[model samples]
Target: MLSPTLITVALAAAMIGALAGVLGTFLVLRGQSLLGDVIAHASLPGVVAGFLISGERGFVPILAGALVSGALAGLSVQLLRRGAGVKSDAALGSVLSLFFALGVVLLTVAQSQGGSAGLTMFLFGQAASVLRADLLPMAVVGGTVLLVLVLLWKEFQLVAFDREAARAQGLPVERLEVLLTLLTAVTIVLGLSLAGVVLMVALLIAPAVAARQWVRGLAPMVWLAALIGALAGSGGAVISAMGQGVATGPVMVLAAVALTALSLLLAPERGLVARWRRQGAARQALRGRQVLAALRGLEGDHATPDYASDEAMLQAYLGTDAGPALARLYRDGLIRPAARLAPEAAARRWELTEAGRLRVEEGGQHA
Candidate 1:
């Protein structure tokens, strides 16, 4: 039996996560991941102003203000990049610091004036405070963002992967870039109540980063990221409900980070573990080939078809450990004990099989 409040909070957080995940994919692909952080910080002033103007912690006013503030911050970065020739990183940093400072000052002023009791909740978020009334508007905004993304998928993809190429292809790269930025800002605003200003960027970025590890294509990556984000959001909400005085935003961020770590360690083609295994396998295969070629060379030089080399001889010839390679080659039937070929005299020496000789001659390995 779950309370309606918890259900509502979970739903709200899930929607926020899904939206952030989808939009954040583009941000991540465009190498503008820090843009989410900039928007999150810049939206803070708007959040405080929205509360001040409404005289209440209403979701609509706060989100609307945050959207405007975030969009302005995005535009400011562009303007600085284009007009003042400031680097994108510098512009983003400047806007984030400026807006966050203004937000802190406004928050202090609102605190002094006194109707701003729960206003600070937006800083770190209070998902427990979410009401059912917040769901409809969040759904509407999230749905619209998703619809726009669906409609402009290809164009966005093009702009994301290659802006110059998109421009050369006669696409409206600038307009598309601005639209993507707006979508990112809107998504960040939607998550503000769930992940808050401080941790919202993590929610936006972590799912996409994790998703990237598991997928190579953009569409699949976006879908997987949304799923991961939703899971993190709902799971965090449930966990927070189970504990006393636990904040939902931080929990959600931690969940997302955990998912990212798992993806980094476990993804088949791209994970650290997978890459390490592949590299080890490649090194082993190279060593096997080297040992085979060395045996073949030794036979050619000595005019003997069956040249048996001991582990020490192979190690000296290869200038590295040869035990693993020898074991692997023996397992693969590419090499065998020299005693099998010469029962008369042998001191645990190895010789290349016909397959190994053919592999070396062909300059390739067996599948």
Candidate 2:
């Protein structure tokens, strides 16, 4: 029941999302997320220039123009950092603002001349404009990016995790860095039509971030990120198709963000909920140990191996609530009620069991 146009848009968005997700893993790991933003915003002038030169909104020319502009922006940042003695952040900021301002000015001129109709869609994206014919090129480019990544997997991994170590091992760190940047530029250009210049960075970052929460290894992270990105893209496209006036790019971004939030809250071992549970368990363990140590101290003070202390005595010694800790220790067979109690004793007393004494001894040794 679906139309061919809607299907094509969905496929295109999915491909773009997968590509962005894969490339974004490296960028996020390297702390170069701003680089994606720089490339995305800086490519705008190239898009306008491509349209101006071709006098049409052709994908090839526009893609070529954007690649060149984005590559130049990347190189400019490097040159500023090494040649001009500027900080990395400063160079990126400068190049991003300069290229984007130029792009805005060029877009204004093109609009005034009345030849830039529909070209403005790249600013926020218009996935409905994608045609079936565009799918082949996107597939080819995306395939090539994946192939190159596969071939250079180990080298890229080395560079991403430790550039100095890679260099020390005689790897071409600079060339690898440039190649990664180029691949990123290509991915960003491919995504411009689906997510647009403004929201493209979100598509790049959100999926990778979400994947990171669920994975620790680079390989699994890349695979998961690609899947998340594709889902966001396709889901957004379907939602946009169902709505009357919704935009595809924003919807896709929102979907990706939602996925990220879910990952942050629910992923095992790394999510916020998981972390809170671990912290709570750790506190409980520490409290149990503290209680055990307190019982041992009370026995030592009385010069009696079976000396027993009531809950009030433990609380007074530890200056905190001891009931929960005592109950947990008792549950674990680490402590027990004293064997003997005076007839007039108002409260029952507790003593450390053999297991509890051994646990305290082990903790002391480790400490």
Could you say which candidate leads in lDDT?
A: 2
Return the TM-score for candidate 2, rounded to 2 decimals.
Answer: 0.95
Regions of candidate 1 where Cα sits further than 4 Å from its true position: 340-346, 365-367
lDDT per residue for candidate 1 within 1-367, as digits (tens), equals 9989889998998888888888889989999899999999999999999988988888889889999999999878877887899998899899899999999999999989998888788889988778898799789989999999999988998998988999999999878988888988998888887788999999889999999999899999999999999999998898988999899999999999999999999999999999999998887778888888887888787788987776677788889988887888889888888754356644368888898888888998641
Best by TM-score: 2
Q: Which residue pairs collide, candidate 2?
A: none
Angstrom error of the Cα, residue 251, model 2: value is 1.2
Off by over 4 Å in 2: 339-346, 364-367
Residue 153 CA displacement from its true place in model 2, Å? 1.8
User: Residue by residue across 1-367, what tens digits does model 2's lDDT show?
Assistant: 8899889999999999888999999999988898999999999999999999999999899888999998889778767877899998999999999999999999999999887888888888989878999999999999999999999999999999999999999999888988998999999999888888899999889999999999999999999999999999999999888999899999999999999999999999899999999888888888888888999998999999988898788999999998898888888888898854677877668998898888888884211
Clashing pairs in 1: none
lDDT of 2: 0.91
